[model samples]
Target: MKKIAITGATGFVGTNLEKYLKRSYKVRTLSVRYVHDQIFNITDDIIIHLAGKAHDLKKVSNPQEYYESNFELTKQLFDAFIVSKADVFIFMSTVKAVADKIDGVLTEEDLPNPQTHYGIAKRQAEEYILGKEISKEKRVFIIRPCMIHGPGNKGNLNLLYNVVKKRIPYPLAAFQNERSFLGIDNFNFMILKILENKNIASGVYNFADDEVLSTNELVQIISETLNKKNLSLAIPKSIINGIAKFGDLVKFPLNSETIQKLTENYRVSNQNIKNAIGVDKLPNTAQQGLEQTIKSFSKK
Candidate 1:
């Protein structure tokens, strides 16, 4: 069995991947407080670096938080990979590195113009890794995945689920928008496939559940999964947009961050990931994954 090193094992993505990896490999973790020492001998091992600064909702996170955790930490890890002679290195980056708001379907070709400090920091790390020199035994990959959600995740999706569970009508029903998200199941599968498939070229890739769900569709899924009536109103979008504008002016809860999330067309394409995995099939559809997550949410 091969040796595997993972950072952010406590995070949703890393924890999900570890479930399968621990069964067949010598799995190790690089704790949040430690770096470039001890069990982190990357020699002849696979390193999946998942630790990074997550996007801050309240905009309270300092700019240095992103650089120190995302860029500097990754830099330290990559330097260790070089010294320890690692074979494959996977960096868990985010779609925000490419664009914070999307006008259409996001692909690997889009030039990165990250708006937030978090995105900027991740993008900087990506640039640094891409600029490095490597020998025959080493490979590097930067994977930018959209919002990842799963059963145990307590993210925006779960918040939406809770709000819907309370039968609170979503105010944004006025905006018919589509967005993409990665199911943790599919993400775990993709990471494993990428690690195993040597023919897949080393570079950047985007991962997401294939189906694009509108906000209303997402609410309906939650409602049905929890056995509630689909209670939504399709009010005119103009009112909602105006309200969002006012929210921004007042720094209200439905402020710029929330508006961008609820209305942005963050439809990232999974073609590069599919091509790398040497298949057109995804392990789980968006609906299936969402169902599983909502079921878990109800139990909690």
Candidate 2:
């Protein structure tokens, strides 16, 4: 079995990936806080770099933390990988590395214009990897995944699930937006394919589910998962915008950032990656994966 070492192994994605790959690969979790140079000595065939400062929705995190954890640490680990015998290196990046707002569907052809510290840091790490010369025997993959959701996911989706569970009406029904989401199962499958297939080239790839869903559709799915009636209010956009501004001033639950998140269209195209992997479609459809996630939330 190929030996795989993953950073941020205790994180949501890392934990799930480690468990999923353990049966086929010898998976080892590496500490991001440890000596960087020692990464070369881990004796792994593959390294999946998942450690980085996640985007802080509260905006309370120090800006420098993003660079230190995402860029600096990744640079260190990657440098070690270059000299080591590791044949494959997979870096977990984000769609935010390209653009905060999607104009049409996001693709690898688009130039990066990151607006946040977290996105900038990840882009820097990606640039560092791209700038380096790789051995003929080695391959590197930088994946930009959109909003990921699955069992144990905690974030806006969980919050929405709670609101629906409490029978609260979704007030953002007036907003019309479509979003791309990555399911853990599909993501795990992609990683496994990347690890097993040497024919695949090394490059940046966008990862997302086959289908996109609007917020209204998502709310309906959540209600259906709980076997409850869907209740959504189409509040006027202007009214909602005013409330969001007030929320910003008071640091309330529905701030400007949260509002943008709920209403923004962030469609990402996975065509390039899919073509490269020679797959017609991912294992799970967006609705199927989302229903599974919503069911998990109901159980909680």
Could you say which candidate leads in TM-score? 2
lDDT of 1 by residue, 51-119 (tens): 887898767987888898898888878887987756889999999999988888899899999998999
Position 127, candidate 2: lDDT: 96
**lDDT (tens digit, per residue) of candidate 2 on 1-300:** 889999999988999999999989999998876344444454788999999889997789999899988998888888888888889999999999999998699999999999999999999999999999999999999999998888898566977888898999899998999999988999999988888789999999999999999989999988888999999999999999999999989989887888888888999999988888889999999999899888887676
Clashing pairs in 1: none
Task: Give candidate 2 misplaced runs (Cα > 4 Å).
Answer: 34-40
Report clashes for each candidate as comma-separated counts: 0, 0
Worst 10-residue lDDT window for candidate 1 reads 33-42
State in Å the error of residue 252, model 1.
Answer: 4.4
Candidate models: Cα lDDT each = 0.84, 0.90
Name the regions of candidate 1 deviating beyond 4 angstroms: 32-44, 245-252
